[model samples]
Target: MEIPNRGKNIMKTLCLAIVLGGLALSSALQAQPSEDTVSVPVSARQLRIDLPDAYSKMWPEDYRDLVANYSLSNGQTLSIISRGTNMYALVDQGPPHKIVSTSRNNYVALDRQLKMEIVLGGDQGASGSVTMVVPSRSLSDGRFVPEQVVLLAFR
Candidate 1:
């Protein structure tokens, strides 16, 4: 029977630990974002948030069943469509705009309807109001769901 040497066993264990440590370090490094994108520091993990609101290659002609009970029409101007107290946003041809910011959850698209946690960096317009809006986000099922879109303007 070959007796195990305490010194040899200790060295072997240390060598194995060093190898595992190197592998773990390399894995962590690989998980980090590429050099190009900006990184947002979030607890538990890092994330990359890219802007330039995702384009809708195919905006369903009837993406949503316009409220039969309520319809916005009669050739109204964009101003008529968008005008809020806190955050003002409307669908436009150019890149979408936002008057609200995002938080851990619940993306508020309008600021005029409720108190905002963060203010916008740009001008809030002449209404003496603060605007903050986020681009519309859609789910895998192709349904539009903004972080927060207050449809009711005080009835």
Candidate 2:
């Protein structure tokens, strides 16, 4: 009958439409970048430094161990702690990165595994404010060259 044929055609068309829609959705998802591949904006919460308790435990009497505290733009905190000749950048309660180099008011810390360097610099004597520079590349041809740099100021 004509009615039966019409119903069959409508069902087939619906099935094809569903299949095509699914394929389109799958392709769109595949085209999107993964979380790891996506780069975080500079305004995001980049610097998270946490103060360590061991430093305090080591020298319970010396309250001067906490060198300075900085407030990031994203409402996060960064702390610089010193223990004798060694200095550390305590980030988000994460493992401390030793302050490798320093020049005047600038302090440089390197995370070799991440291939990134964090530089903190300020004009005043650890009082006014600090500028944090995160560079994605290391030194090239004996000079520090960065492919991408993110600058965050501490207030």
Candidate 3:
């Protein structure tokens, strides 16, 4: 049995259309922006604070005006206290750091001497976490090191 010429031509045309459709679909997909290439807007503000103590201070015996307290996963306690218009973070009875609010629930504390930044974010008066970006030291010369990010969860 031999296929008709007309039928062969129709089959060839269908195959070509399918091939072209596939190519078009592939090209359309390629033209789309990749999920990995995301651009986020960043805003930087310069803040100057004057305090009697360092950014972080030990848990004060007579501390007042408590705002929120969280317990970290590493058996550490983090307390946020308010004094006038500023907020302070006292971690595990350690030194308190003056954390400046960036947003409704986002706060950041910077140590210029150590070139370290600590970012705290999450629902205020609820669960939250702290992220510390600290500068790393080069093993060879103890200088020219990159920054290391450390995340600590709290509740």
Q: What lDDT is obtained when candidate 2 is compared to the true structure? A: 0.43
lDDT of 1 by residue, 1-155 (tens): 55346334333333443454465557656766886644433553221222224322212231111111211121111221122333233322222233333432122333233222222223532111212222345544776544332211110
Q: Give model 3's TM-score versus the native structure.
A: 0.39
TM-score of each: 0.20, 0.36, 0.39
Question: Where does candidate 1 stray beyond 4 Å?
Answer: 1-4, 34-155
- Top-lDDT candidate index: 3
Predicted candidate 2 versus true structure: per-residue lDDT over 6-61, tens digit per residue: 34433333344345446655765665588455443455443333232232222323
lDDT, candidate 1, at 54: 32
Q: What RMSD, rounded to one decimal, does every model reach?
A: 24.3, 21.6, 22.4
Pick the winner on TM-score between candidates 2 and 3. Answer: 3
Clash pairs detected, candidate 3:
55-97, 56-95, 56-96, 56-97, 57-95, 57-96, 58-95
Instruction: List candidate 2 segments past 4 Å from native.
Output: 1-66, 112-149
lDDT of each: 0.30, 0.43, 0.48
Error of 3 at 40 (Å): 18
* lDDT of model 1 at position 16: 41
